[model samples]
Target: MTSTPPSPDAISYFGIEVPFMQHIGLRPLLLDSDRCHTLLAMRPDIVNSRGDIHGGTLMSAFDFTLSGAARAHDPERLGVITVDMTTHFYEPARTDLTVIGRCTRRGRSLAFCEGEIVDTAGTVVAVARAVFKLVVRQPA
Candidate 1:
C-alpha cells in the first residue's frame, strides 16, 4: 500500500540519529492538520518475549510520535519532558504496526496527547495518553 509522505516538520523534529527510533526502523508516515495528528510506523523486530511487541517499545514509539505532533504544531524554541504516561494493552502486536498520536489539548506549559497502536491487520493493540511539560529554550 502507498502511504502518505511525512511532513517536513516531522523530519525536522525526529533527527536521523535518534538511536531508539533507528534501531526499530521507525518512520513517520503522515502528518495532517485537518486531523490534528501524526502517524508513525515500526517494523516487526521491535518485539519482546512471547513474540509480542514489547509494551515499553510501543510506549516509546507513542511518546515520540506525540512529541512530533506537539512540535509540528509549535516549532519555535521549545523542548518537552514527559510528566506522566498511561497505556492500555488491548492485543498482542505480531506484525509491523502504526501509531497515530493526536494532541488533545495544549496549554502554556503542558500538552495532553493520546495515541493508538494498530497492527498490520488494523487491530487496535494499544492505547496511550501522556502529559508533557513544555519548556521554552534559551539561546546561548
Candidate 2:
C-alpha cells in the first residue's frame, strides 16, 4: 500500500539535523528517492545590504537540498558530504523561493546532484550542480 505523503513540517529535510540549516529557515517541502523540494521564506536576515537575497543564502540552500536528494535513497541509514558545487545566478531574488534538487547519478561512494531555485513569482533565481560523497550514518 502506498503510504500517505508527509506534510511539509513533518519531514526532517536534512536527513540529519543541522543547526545552521535551521537557523537559515530552510524547511522541508518534499522528498523522494531521487529528488527533494524545499522552501525558503524571505527574511530580513537573508537580505543583503542592497536588499536582495544574499547569494550565500542561495548557495547554502542548494548545498543542503542537493545533499538531501543524494541521500534520499536511504536517508536514515546514509549521509552525504558535499565535495564540490557550482552555482549560477540568473536573477536577483527578492522574495520567498523554492529549491528543487535532483540526484542525477549515484555511484557506490558518490552522487551527482543538481538544484534550481525559483522565486514566488516563478522566476529562475539560481541553479547549481554538486558532487557529494556518501557515507554510512553511524548510530548516535
Top-TM-score structure, candidate number: 2
Best by lDDT, which number? 2
Which window of 10 residues has the lowest lDDT sum in candidate 2? 2-11
lDDT per residue for candidate 2 within 17-130, as digits (tens), equals 665777889988988899999999999999999999899999999999999999999888998889999999999989999999999999999999998999999889999999
lDDT of each: 0.69, 0.90
Model 1, residue pairs in steric clash:
none
What's the lDDT of the predicted structure labeled candidate 1? Answer: 0.69
| TM-score for candidate 1, residues paired by index | 0.76
Give one digit per residue, the lDDT tens place, for model 1 in 1-140: 55555544443334323456655556766655312233444445666767787888888888877766555455456667888889999998777788888878888888888888888798999998888888775543
Q: Which runs of model 1 end up more than 4 angstroms from their true locations?
A: 1-17, 32-45, 138-140
